[model samples]
Target: MSRRTRRHITPLITAAGAAGAVLLSATAATAHVRVIGDVIPGKPATLQFRVPSELAEATTVRITVEVPKDLMVTSVPKLDGWNQETLPGAGGKGTRLVWTAEQGHEIQPAQSETFRANVGPIPDRYSLTFNTEQTYSNGTAVAWNQPRTGAEEPEFPAPVLVVDPEAGPPPGSAGGAQQPGTSASAPAPSVDAATPQPAAAEDSDSDSSLPLVALIGAGAAVAAALAAAVLRRRGARDGSHL
Candidate 1:
C-alpha cells in the first residue's frame, strides 16, 4: 500500500479501537432503590426508599412497596393523602406493610418521591421490592415491577432494598457479662507474690576452699622474707673473713 494511504488508515484504525474500548467499559448501571442509614439490631431504624417518576409520561397514580416478611417490620407511620395495607404472611406470623399512593399523589415527569418507614429487629437479612403502578389520565396502568437484567432496558423498573445482618458484639463478650471499659466493678487480672531467696551457708563445701587459699598465700610471703635475710647475713660474713 502507498505510504500516504497507510498513514490515512492508521488514524482511522486507532480512533476505532479507542471508541470500542470506551463502549465496552460503559456497562449499563441499573437503577435500584438502595437502603441507606444505619440498621441496628433490636432497635427501630428509619429507612427511606427513593422512587423515580420518569418511568412514564403519565402522572403516577399509585405506588406500592412490598415489605419482605423476613425483615419483621412491625409498623409504619401514617401519612396524609396516603393509604396503607398490611397483608399477613403464611401462618399469620407477621404482616407485610404496603403503601398505596392515592389520587393527586401522582409524581409528575422529572420528579421523585421518598417513602419513609420505621423498621426494626429483623430476624434475618432480607430484601424488599417496591412495585409502583402509575396510572395516567388515559386509563393506562404502568407497572414498575420489571427489573433490569444485564444490558436490557426495562420500561418501568422497580427499586429493591436489601437489609443486611447487623454486626454483633466483639470477641469474649458473649455471655452477657459486663464488657471491659464499662464499670470498675469488673474483675481485674490477679498478680502472684514473689518467693524469698535463701542465704549462703558458711560451712558449705563451695566456701571451704577460701581459707586454704589464704593460708598458702601467707606462708609463701614469710618464706620469701627469711631467704632475703639469710642472703644478706652470708654477704656480711664473707666480707669480714676476706
Candidate 2:
C-alpha cells in the first residue's frame, strides 16, 4: 500500500475505535440510576441515586424516584445548595421523592449528581427497584422504569439494590440466616454405609477363608499325634528299667 493510503487507513481505524468506545459508554449510562453505599437488610441504610446529564448544551434540573411499597424511606437529605421533598403515597408511605437545584445549581452537561436518602429498617429482601424520572433545564423529561432487555436497555431503567442473602445479620440481631425474597440453598444429600455380613451368610466370604481354616486344622492334628508317640516311648523305657 502507498504511504498516503496507510496514513489515511490508520486515522480511520483510530476514529472508529474511539467512536465505538463513546457509544458503549453512552449505552451503559442510560441503563439505570445507581444505588451507592452499603445495603444491609433489616437495618438503617443510606441510598444515593446517581444521575448523569447527557446533552452537551443542556443542564439537568430535576430528579425523582418512585419508592416501592416494601421500602420505608425515612428522610430525603438535601445536598448543599439543593432542595428536596418526599411526596406521600396512597398508604401514607413515601411514594414519590424529588430533588431540585435552584437558579444556577442545575447539573451541567458531562456532570453528575447523587441524591441521597437516609432510611431505616431495610426490608428482608434480595432486591429492591425504584422507578426514576429525570428532567432537564430544557424541560425534557425521561422515565427510567423498566428491566433490561438484551443490548437495548430502557431509556431510563429503574435503580436497584441487590441484597446479599448470606450477609450476617445486624449487630444485636438474632440469627444470621438467609434473607427473605432470596432463594434457599438446597441441602446436602444423606448417605448410608454398607453393613458387613457373617462368613456363613455370604458364599464369597466362605470361599475366601476356607484355605486358611483347612491349614490350621491339619497342623493341630499333626501336633496331637507327635505328642502321643513321645509319651508312649517314654513309658516303655521306664517298664524296662523296672
Highest lDDT scorer: 2
The lDDT per prediction is 0.52, 0.67
> Model 2, residue 45: what's the lDDT?
92
Query: What overall lDDT, based on C-alpha atoms, would model 1 receive against the true structure?
Result: 0.52
Query: What does candidate 1's lDDT look like per residue over 1-242, in tens digits?
Result: 23642233321112323322111112221333334546644556777766554433344444445555555565677867667676764377545455556778765544656667777664344444555444332234445566544344454556554444343322332222354567646665554334333434545755899899999999999999999999999999999999
TM-score of each: 0.42, 0.54
- The runs of at least 3 residues in candidate 2 whose Cα sits more than 4 Å from the true structure, single-residue gaps closed, are 1-32, 90-94, 149-152, 165-242
Model 1 quality (TM-score): 0.42
Question: What clash pairs does model 1 have?
Answer: none
TM-score winner among the candidates? 2
Tell me the number of clashing residue pairs for each predicted model.
0, 1
RMSD of 1: 17.8
